[model samples]
Target: MPIAFDTTGWQQHDRATWFNPGNGDQVTLSYFDLVPDLPASLDDLPKLRHDLAVVVGEVGCLIEAHVVRLGDVPALLQVVKVPLPNQPSGQVFLGSFTVPKADSSAVLKLQAAERGMTGMREAVLVAQLGFENWVMPHPYAPEVQGRLPFHAGDDPRFDPQFADHPLSRLRAWAHHVVRTARVDPRFAALPPFRPATQPPAAQPPAAQAPAAQAPAPQAAADTGAADTSADVTGPTSPADFTAPPTPTPPADFTPPGESPAAPEPEPAAPEPSNPAAPPGPAVGSTLTTVVPGLPIGGYLPLWVGEQCTFWRMSDPEAVLDKLGLGALARTPLTDRRFRDLVALDASSATITLLDRYRAEDGSTGGSVVRLTRVSGQEAHQALTTDTLLDAFRRLGRISLAAAERGEHVTLEPGTHNGDLAEPYVLLAVEEHEGRPVATARTAPPPPPDTPMWQGTAAVTAPATRESVEAGGLLAMYAMNTWGEHPLRLCLTFGPR
Candidate 1:
């Protein structure tokens, strides 16, 4: 077989001899599967047309990927990159032996898409535009899925500049992946794997939303929810509340040595006023794409912070194969990004994003503000449950733009009191400190009818009054902004 290591730095490629480079030529069902593309619905697409331009908008490759085994246990040798027809380039990525033997390719694709979803917002929803042209769904299909503008085939050359293009972002994403693999003991000890295995059973796919063969009819209850799909506020949006009388609690509520001296004081260390409430369990959810026309991936990992945001990507099938669905899909609420931002907050420099703005310059000249810690009582009200994603997404967008622009930042750039008006949901605010903590999660699953997927955002905690109020609006805007790719797929700088 044409041999080489894939992105994950593991043995990869089909076991078939056609995978061999020694053979002059070979043909097999290996090529039967068409490169994937976005589908509105199977019934909606009576014929397969390979028009990435029609499928997605602007396309930029993934820049980097940080892969970790989804579960505690691991197996199999998985490859994570595209193989050219020539020499091999062993890229380090993550995959599991446990992935069902059946149609592993589709699972691998899903797993790769998931990896993209974890660290960066753009990692999910792959764009079809400016992509290369490959063969159609079934080379002889009545309609073709068409080809990407160019083939990444071996010996093919692209402008060196494209190496840095988002279209080719993973060129380096694999670098760290290999570094990670060398240390991953499971990788070092895998038994020689035969990529060829028994095809998967007829079990329903985890990433594919609906049962295969036929669509499950929606229940009448589903119809009611469908009408209110735009409510956006979630289940808690409707509730009853009344103002409560407030009074000073006992002196025990005060810290030692800080309580007011009383002629006859009730002396005691301040007791905890309130303990944190348990966050709700995973709830039924609905997700949408940030970039319109982008093909949905298998998994979504959300990262949120005071000013940083990321979504780490992994292949769901690989994760499932190695870790099982429950393991990789833990979909942890607090990801590394959130924890790092929390750590950064300890020494964070407050930047007034509103500073240096001139009304003439189209920005309000804002004031100075400090970053403050959120109190237990204030966490919910400040970071409100529904809107956490807005803040994180806005930050994620700005962070990327900042890197692209190579802009250095010091203190919070906002005027001492100026606010950063971004397109996101605000979660928490320390007005005294001028710090806002926002949280958001994402779920990018395959389509309900087909094995296609995208994303859903979940938030924890609350923001200041303003942040909470704007959460709904932010969610709506997010849906619209990323709803579609604005252009044709695969716009090559030159010719195809």
Candidate 2:
């Protein structure tokens, strides 16, 4: 059935696909023609549920299932949770509605996977089960030698605890989907569904010798297709779980792919320390000679603001350790203290710290710092010509008036300007002979209390010798945040 729902607060990734802004939760709609092995009759909801459990295997557990209706058409609603095979500590909660017809079916699915609550739920189960360690078979799955008896008190399916849990959120979204669903008149006109005595069999190997082998059925995630495969019985390994490949954009669009390495550092240049004073330009260095990009010689980009500073590091764990928050590296993303100390930004290689320290007034305040890491190639391209132009094309483009005037200019989202609400860049240009040369520096970050939704206030400051140099180019764009982190549309890259 052609279905539509309230997609409020969801960012559309592509056709029939959307993702939650910050949490990495995803939802999609898809159609199927004769799910390979399902009972033909849509009325056999129990069989459908059983088949779902079997198809998901031991790696996943069915939290709930119900025979529901999409408009007037009957459908099966299922909630399943599966741990990601790749991540050390994370689980994906899947909620799906399958509407089956005589010859076709449609599915609307939602996937939510987060760090903090997954760990907490697992810990609660482990503590109650008395498991020797965290890595153990699911408590509710087919019993393993070391698996403990399932208890209703702590079981996520039975317990009404952790209301804000990802699974709980998925269930709520499912209800929203069902309530808001609309059916297509053409689909509803199709013949009613009827069950066959037995499910269809696959073609014999000898019968299809000349043809390519049928690929194994995969998890219906990215494409939103129905998963059709034989029941996985007995024990199943973690590797059996299939996850879709998700693209992660880089923090700066300078390209993370192979490029030339940075040139050797000067003999007197010092290695940039984690929390140390950010390295400065060499003595007698000028904006014309010293341009900012990614730091060379093992140094990182550092932006010191009035309320906070932005730092770039090669390794987040090592830098966090020096900040005395080594434990944060192991903490869940949902922990209260962890969330309090850290704010979500782009890139796992980066860290946004709100340090708890006493100010001169003896009042407790959090000193905010935004840290990001860059590859040698990304840094190299930021200072080069050809690749830099290519990377800038992917972002919202803009042109600064620095070539004609060295004064500050207000920038807003529009044609010839970035898509961000405010311009966070400072440009300085001077005429050399008949040609114009320029330097671009980042403005200080907004105050810690400034609401990001409202956008950071315009920052005006002199260009630093470390800012990127624009010999003749006067273009700029809002830099992209990388990794699975939500897009901030912050950070400005100029001279491309």
Candidate 3:
């Protein structure tokens, strides 16, 4: 007998991977099972009802798993009218799992078991009900059902060839039913469903109007109030506020037993000196070249302030590299008239190389090398007075020893000139009384049109043995190159 249930609200609830026996690929089935809370009367009817829904699709992806009532009637009204035996709701499992493509029977059995159906009979009933009244029912022709091979014994089994048989194909087809239903307008207007897992929205407290306040009581007037103006007089004139005059002391009056203080002594006049010249280098100050033969040619003082020392170097690459500028030496010199400016910020030991270009207007432009702190410190320490002097002395000894060998002392090209030079001249200024007086050699002006090296010259005569015996040793140096090159390397030490 055909089931008497209505198919109105019966939604398709087939697993996404339902198998097609004919092609051996998973297929989409279309049919809805009765929802859990649907009228129990329809549960046993063996047919879809107008109001029934099922949790369809994969378990995690289940959709439309809601409890709906028949027609527009309230659930309570339907329950009161319909006689449905109270029975535990039947489970209608929905979802697909992996299966061998070659076997059609196994696929069907697995699908049925997943749907909570028992035995072959229950599975067959579900397939039939899902196919009935579907808009696009599987196995369109009724004759296809007869072609499917079915085992006759109580135990449902099929031959290996059964997959190719018409009955097997129809069974697979029956499981795939596509049905479309009109969505009720009322459902669209309903509020969206919020899952129970989420906490309820907090409601804002209602705004309350402020209570009206009563007017304050009025103060009673006093019958007799005093008039404060009667006690106050008119403002006084400025002349009436004069202070008493200070008393004057007699000419000969002095404090008892204290003799008159002696008049302050006048300050002595300073002794006269030559006004034509500026006060010469603090009398006892001495100027000495710490590292002589410091080739200053092709170099310009870019900056020389208390905290900053900058020099533009135009020396050969080999020379600059030796002077703690190996990195700058490696960089290609693109400009025709470019010089590397070595800048030292006293606070930081890093020596920054600024590639300066001499423009046609004699102005300069350049970029500074970005050096790390460690590299800067290393470079700065390499150029310290102590380090350079040590290297200078060692090189000088080597040159003198070679000369003593009776061989021509040909200094190596690109070698520092100070390496083969004489010992640097050290000068000491004699101290007059407690103050030390400074003495410096003034280089005579170079011949006209000649580029004169403007720097302090060393004293021609070394200090006498008596001067050496003097307490103060004003300066020390490793070598001197006063008149050798067309440049003078002058080092001014002391408080300056």
- What is candidate 3's lDDT per residue for 1-496, written digit by digit as tens? 0001112122212311223343332322111111112222312222111222111111111111112332221111110001011211112212221111110100111121111211223223322322111111111121211111111211114423344332343333332311111112222222222223334344335323225322211111111122212111111221221111111211112111112233445579889975452122233444221121232322322223211222333233333333321122111112221112344432332234433335698755432222223232333434544434333332333222322332111111111222322323223343356543322222232222221112334222112221221101111221222243212232211111
Q: Which lDDT value does model 3 have at 164?
A: 36
RMSD of 3: 46.8
Go through the candidates in order and give each one's C-alpha lDDT.
0.22, 0.39, 0.23
TM-score on alpha carbons, each prediction: 0.17, 0.37, 0.14
- Say which prediction, candidate 1 or candidate 3, comes out ahead on lDDT: 3
Arranged by TM-score with the best first, the candidates are 2, 1, 3
Q: Which is better, 1 or 2, measured by TM-score?
A: 2
Looking at model 2, the pairs that clash are: 41-195, 116-334, 251-482, 292-466, 292-467, 292-468
| Cα misplacement distance, residue 259 of candidate 2 (Å) | 40
Q: Which of the numbered candidates is closest to the native, going by highest TM-score? A: 2
lDDT of 2 by residue, 33-149 (tens): 553234334556566555544445434555556777765656767676665555423456777776655565556777777553234454344334322222333333333221111
Task: Tell me how far the alpha carbon of residue 406 in candidate 3 is from the true structure, in angstroms, after superposition.
Answer: 34
